[model samples]
Target: MPQHTPDHPTRQILTLDTGVDAVEPGPDQRWSTWPSIAKGQRGPHPHPDWVVTAAAALDTELGVLKTGKEADVFLVERAVPDDPDRAVLLAAKRYRDTDHRQFHRAGTYTEGRRERRSRDQRATQDRHSAWGRSVRATQWADAEFATLCALWEAGAPVPYPVQIDGTELLLEFVGHVDDAGAAVAAPRLAQTRPDTDLLADWFEQVRSAMGVLARLGWAHGDLSPYNVLADGERLVVIDLPQVVDLVANPFGAELLHRDCRNMGAWFAARGLEVDVDALFAEVFAQAW
Candidate 1:
């Protein structure tokens, strides 16, 4: 998610990759919109140490199920801390080493959630310096961790954060014992339709996940194709690194609503129809 610079780097690839649906890169340069905001995270490398620690904790484990952002996910069998014989398959999320420049503008999502009145006050101030960046990076990782834990507690469809072992975080793996290798590429509500009953069940999971978010007063800010993995019976949401601010993110409702819409569209593609507007209306009805 690089910034919307005219010629910095990935801009060319994105232009070539998604020319039609692409929102023309803005020229404001004030760090107000998506590209400028996304620019802070310019690489796939983990911009935080927690991510690296997360990876190191799960490396070289047999049967590691891979799926995630910032950190690589592995499905590994390890003995439970309390019971040595009770080995379990855990999905280990490890953060890769990402540069600090990737998070200079992240204050926009965090500050708004804690502020009293204004959001622009601390949106993108001088936080890219040595000390400021270090603090901001921690805040960024913590925020994502909060959302992941929140989703886990709310019974949303995602892996639970088992333990934050320094940089490595562990959770119950999604696939079953036999189907571990069947897990395909990241699957979002935007892609794939297995069958009627299966697609219907997935719709329920997606909707139910959104319901959990609304009940908890949060949004899956980064809901999209790249953040999901389709294992036989479930739609597991990944990528929590950039989940938006429920308050400051001008697109919170729209983001959540679009999540519902995306799921609805996916269902429709599979001959299952749903009223996208009604779904959105119902989920955020209490909020508005």
Candidate 2:
């Protein structure tokens, strides 16, 4: 193990030591918007703390790349900058305690049933005792880190996970952190303003991604227009917390089939004659 001292160059990565001051068992209603998002939603948002922590840990002051409903991504620095591509970007998933009494998120998002179950379990656990908050916090930390590592090892185009501590996740940042000139906005295949050549390129990229999926024994459980990012000539996939390991799950084959089908459907929607069945067959057949 590397002995990372306080002043060690690698010590730029920070820690999620945000103070948990709420001793009493209660929920914050202001940010509670999900049906079960905040069931165990406790304390204030630790993202800011996590952000600062990740930056210090990675040894770079990460500029904000983008902000979504659940997380914020930042382009942090690499511990050693000798190599130009040696730096790492941090995607600090700010834990959202958006669970409230008004909305039913459980009914809305049908993507990752397992993740949903974990959320519900945490929420249930959160309501009963203060320890539920601890459990929920640790679970989210584990899920994101585990998936990020899996994809990286599987040759998937994703931010590589460095280390996951507390509510913070340190990993390789994607793109130039989304700037005007260096930004690669996630191109919804449905809305991409590409020519025929670009369309073919996209088809090949999605197909290659499917290959990566099949080779890795996993599949993007909810691949669609939103998850694909157009990084210049290459189309990179993101938001894969629901990626399932096919070799581990019996229903994984169906998930992988649906993944290719989903991508094929996107092409078909654009008037391309995509044979979803053949594509599914090719992806599932383990010739490798």
Q: Give a tens-digit lDDT track for model 2, residues 81-190.
A: 23322233354455444331222332212233354456556564455666565555455455666765555555556644555555656554444433332423344455
How many angstroms is residue 275 displaced in model 1 relative to the true structure, after the best TM-score fit?
A: 2.3
Alpha-carbon RMSD to native, per candidate: 16.1, 11.2
User: What lDDT does each candidate get?
Assistant: 0.51, 0.52
State, as a TM-score between 0 and 1, how close model 1 is to the true structure.
0.61
Assess the local accuracy of residue 245 in candidate 2 as a C-alpha lDDT between 0 and 100.
62
What ranges in model 2 sit over 4 Å off?
Answer: 1-70, 74-90, 97-127, 177-191, 247-251
> Could you say which candidate leads in lDDT?
2
lDDT of 1 by residue, 167-218 (tens): 4555545544334433233444455657788877777877776777777766
Residue 119 of model 1: what lDDT? 37
